[model samples]
Target: MTTTTHALAAPPDLGALYRRAVLSGLSGFLRRGGDLPNTTLELPAVTTDVEHLGAYARVCGFRLRDELPATYPHVLAFPLSVQLMADPSFPFPLPGLVHVRNQITQFRPLMVDEVFALRVRMADLRPHERGQQFDVVAEAVVAHQVVWRDVSTYLRRTGGRGGPRGDVRREAPEPSGLWRVPADVGLRYAAVSGDRNPIHLNRFAARAFGFPRAIAHGMWTKARCLTAFEGRLPDALLVDVHFRAPVPLPSRVAFSAHADASGWLFALHDPRRGKPHLTGSINLI
Candidate 1:
């Protein structure tokens, strides 16, 4: 019999599962805490079989119904999301787990068979009271270089899973660039990550859960930003980003970035509204 998992449900105590899995993965370059220690995940080069590349084309909004989006790599370690949920320590019923804020500073588009390791080190895990969610930050590294850093905040409610009724984020302020995120755009991005989070699709489904219309996956938006930095620096590494407001569907957005010798600065602007969605810096190795 074939086993199937609901993409949306949180994974069960996955620390052990991840521990077992990572050992067989890219353990060569990883040590408990070698200079830049982080959770490392290595994905083999994706084959060029017609079926696989077809899916990638589809994600990027291609009609071939075969191609997937270039953003697929953002979730290269997406399975880890489930792994984190599987950990018993993985905070359940917490808001931060719900991902209140998401930002991505992409250096370039990833081609097939990149064969890279995703190293994640805890950045911040503490209490925060922004809206109603718990939050955490992890500095994610790839290719022995800091590709990007992330902050994930979530929301939790009591009597749902019957755990704790609270939300928090433990981080200070950094402006985020604003982009005109459209619902149709969101639907397209969610397809790649397999997040299928109703909030990112199906307006009716979103409102049922407490969203106005479908919102873009935080990572999808991040992926679009990643495209902005491709080939601009010498071996792109070192990224900082933040999530500001939810970009709604059918809207116009302005994205702008500036890079100096020390690092690159980026921003998402809602030209009509004069508000920045996110702002951050990127340092080159």
Candidate 2:
């Protein structure tokens, strides 16, 4: 066959490859947990073994017992995630995606002794827009629950992918619940997020930042929002949250969320302290 014929025989449109990534039938093409093809991701479990933690930290480039840091799960699941994108069936380009916001809840505090299985799958996808930027959102589930979640938007600079562009035009809600943070919680979150920002781990440093105590990880506050409504609302909640303040860690607080049929409102509160820590909202289905 001539070169022209061979070239013709090959396909031109690459978007078709994404459709081949078995659509598991969710809200949108990909929206809710279990909406993508069956994929299992097993993250190495953390253990009390001293050698293991040290070695794992060295290999992962994190300090030992320094708090898992909120971003740990993303690193934990990254190796397998490569396969999903390289498979050519998924729509996202590996390096082009940008994380708009990432949040994770420290359920029982990700300790050094617990072994966790990070079950990753695609959830919630639609053309995202920020003035001129466009991208998508996918949620990651750990075990059977959605623990670490991130809304990543990808910019197809070369051309358009023509993903769903159905974005609701509405007013953004403010977070009403705010609480004063305690000291101990800061220590624990630092352990999970692997971030030892002295402001979050040391009182003296916190004083420098003008905080009475070390503050919480921004992701931790985001995680608290996620944990507050985990499995309580629709299986999939597509929210666009912007973090503005660092919640003081370990603040004993009560939270109130008054979500109407049209929108969701979240607030952080420390009834005793009588102030707001951080505020954010999610557009629930």
Q: Write down the lDDT of every candidate, Cα atoms only.
A: 0.46, 0.45
Worst 10 residues of 2 by lDDT: 2-11
Clash number for model 2?
A: 23
lDDT of 2 by residue, 39-72 (tens): 4334433234455445444432345553443434
Error of 2 at 13 (Å): 39
Predicted candidate 1 versus true structure: per-residue lDDT over 131-232, tens digit per residue: 234333333344566444444545433224422222222222233444455547666655545465556777886676566776666565555675665545
For candidate 2, give the lDDT: 0.45
Candidate 1 all-Cα RMSD: 11.2
Off by over 4 Å in 1: 1-72, 86-89, 94-111, 114-124, 131-182
Candidate 1, after superposition: displacement of residue 230 in Å?
3.2
Least well predicted 10-residue stretch by lDDT in candidate 1: 31-40
Residue 136 error, candidate 1, Å: 7.0
